[model samples]
Target: MDEQGVRGSGSPPTGRFRRGAAWWRSGPPWVSRWGAEGGRDGGAAWPWPSTLLLTVFVLVGSSFAAHGQEGERAALDPFARVLLLVAAGLLLWRRRHPVAVLFGTSAAAATYLGAGYPYGPVFLTVAVACFSAVVAGHRRAAWAAVGALWAAHVLVAHWLYRWLPPTGDAAVSWGQEAVVLAWVVAIMAVAELARARREQWARDRAERAQAARRRADEERLRIARELHDVLAHSISVINVQAGVGLALLDSDPEQARTALTTIKAASKEALGEVRQVLDNLRAPGEAPRAPAPGLDRLPELVTQAAGAGLTVEVEGEPPRLPPGTDLAAFRIVQEALTNVVRHSGSRHARVRLDKAAGTAGDPRGAALRLCVDDDGPATGADAGGSGNGLAGMRERAAALGGTIEAGPRPDGGFRVLAVLPLDGATAKEGER
Candidate 1:
């Protein structure tokens, strides 16, 4: 087959085989797309290359052995040369049809020996075929083929020597059989080792692919959470201000203008934050280290809530927290107040921040606490939420080894309480 035909597709082998030795490794054009057999590891056109080298080695080595063993064995004739070629040629299909190729190589080698051709590198063809078969996940078939060849050799060398060529040849000694047995055992041992190594490499590659997929999934989830927090809180305020603006557009033009002004500010801030998040996605390494929203931005959220007509009460003081805990705290507060504005009948909500007393067996700076509350008969029975806001809040808290408790209070209101861990989360972030 020509180079293009054997390659199946591509510019042709270029680096090592620039001199066009491809024909030495390939057969007829009809079988060029060898890897399409659906059970091999190499490309569609590149079967085993070593098969050609083995052919050359066997032909040359057998010629030298023939002269040395001329007195004791059948001369290397044209027929013997044909057998050598047949054995080596069968190995070309070993990758795609390992079992079949092994069977063919073994039969040809056994026939060559049984015909009393001088033994030299003839057995090497069978050994190469068996090694390829075993490494291709066909160990049982390889062993069977090798065992069949050994059995045929025993039959010829011991009982059928008289009928074989080189008449008057005596039965081979038991020591020669022992040597053949050892040789066969060694071939199987090396092949088995190679098979194990291939399996291990495949497993390692699969594990690395799985790990890459897992990291991508995590990054996607984090970006979604950031977008949800930025949009939901900002959009909720815009929704409130737009409603106020429309209600007072005719009778109270100044109030309407004030509400529209708030809408513009809220939208501008939302777009800026959204752009920051997306810029990090598009060029994460080069994006500026703009500070992420944290409790430091808590007062800005309160100002936005006031414009939306939800009067927010503040208590206690925000702490200097680890970046993870700070961001989770900020998002949790923003989402809670957003829920109050969107779902509750009450226009008043309270937010409190405190350095929490750690849970049992934990250090003092181990947690920060946030609480948001609104007196409410909600707009509906399911006024809780129908979106990712609450779920995103819980995910953020849980990721930092923290907890969020958002439920109805006994005194007829909704309350969201979050306790975020400090020390462990900081350590984990540093490790990352």
Candidate 2:
């Protein structure tokens, strides 16, 4: 019965050492289920020495009890002795079969008492089996076994001693029995509480893991959006230049050469930025790359736009800006120039950057202003009404605690104006 219970409880089929090897070779069932196979090497093997010590103590204690009482020893029948031994043997598999051990040992102890044998070893066996049941996650079984043993003790003692007159001294024995029962129930209650705590901890750990996964998915989506918005415009420019080069290769050699060069430069820059983003995705442990296209790169950006046949002029010097502010400034300029080439149908464009003392006590300490004016016809034609380019530029500036205004100027041209805070040190530090 104990063997059957051990099998039913899903314990390892092999010896403790072999089970430890299996647990190490392929991680425990819980870890494997979560796809964390092959964790640490091996946990501590089962403590065989403790089992050996318990066995030795039980055998020696029973032998000593049998030797000390002559009449009790003689009255013990062979069947009773065998039952006691079976009860003791059941202890070997107690951890894997607590319910079966409790039942079998309780029944065997009852039989031993019925056969008129000494009750010392039988009582000891019941105590050990009850404790084992409580420790092995079988609180309900432990309570039931305690009740059955208490009932059997009362019935057997009453039946054996009923012929004698009652001395009215039942209070002490009843008190001892009550104390023992209370102790066993209290121990089982403590174990149950501990099990509940462990379950709560497991639930908390699972919730934290789920939240982390959700956060990672959100971050990935955000990164994808940024990549699309930043790189798509450059890719579109490259595509247009490549198409022009292909069409003019046979009819206009010099124009085709210029277009090819522009395409090559645009493609190279796009590949570099894309590679940086990909690297960040693949190896998150590495430090991040430099900030993407800050204000410092504005000169090269303007030169590239000019090479693409749009005349660009820069005026005025601005105060140093925060990293995010600089990035926003660069992107606004890039998008504005791209719009000029793609939609404005303008031959000349001017970019102005200026810094001035704060007015109206805005709390930014200093104000940085940017203006882009294009000498193009104000008529809504050639992707003029799309508004995507202007919206993107405005979003970039607004993200840096700035505002933008874009519309047709009264002088028959288009204009974009933005005002951003220069003293954003507190905001930048807070982000870090």
TM-score of each: 0.88, 0.55
Give lDDT for model 2: 0.65
TM-score of 2: 0.55
Rate residue 262 of model 2 by lDDT.
87
lDDT of candidate 2 over 1-432, digit per residue (tens)? 111111122232222222344553443455432222312332222323454565566556666776676453334556656776777767655655678888888888776755555546566666677776776568788788878877776665556434322222122277776776786567566667766776788889999999889879756754654465466556656766777789999999899998888888888887887888788889978976855667777787776776666788999864577766776777777776766666566768999999868777667778778888897753223332233555556656665667887766776567778887777744853553
User: Per-residue lDDT for 1-432 in model 1, tens only?
Assistant: 111111122133422222334554444344444322222244334454577788889999999999999889999989999999998888777766778889998888988998888989989989988998899888889888999999998899889998888988999899999999999999999999999998999999999999989889978999998998888888888988998999999999999999999999999999999999888988978945688889998899899999988899999889888887788899999988888887777889999887866666675356888999888656643233445877888889888888888777778778889988886898766654
Best by TM-score: 1
Tally clashing residue pairs in candidate 2. Answer: 0
The reply for model 2, stretches above 4 Å from the true place, is 1-172, 222-230, 281-283, 289-292, 298-432
| Prediction 1 TM-score vs. true | 0.88
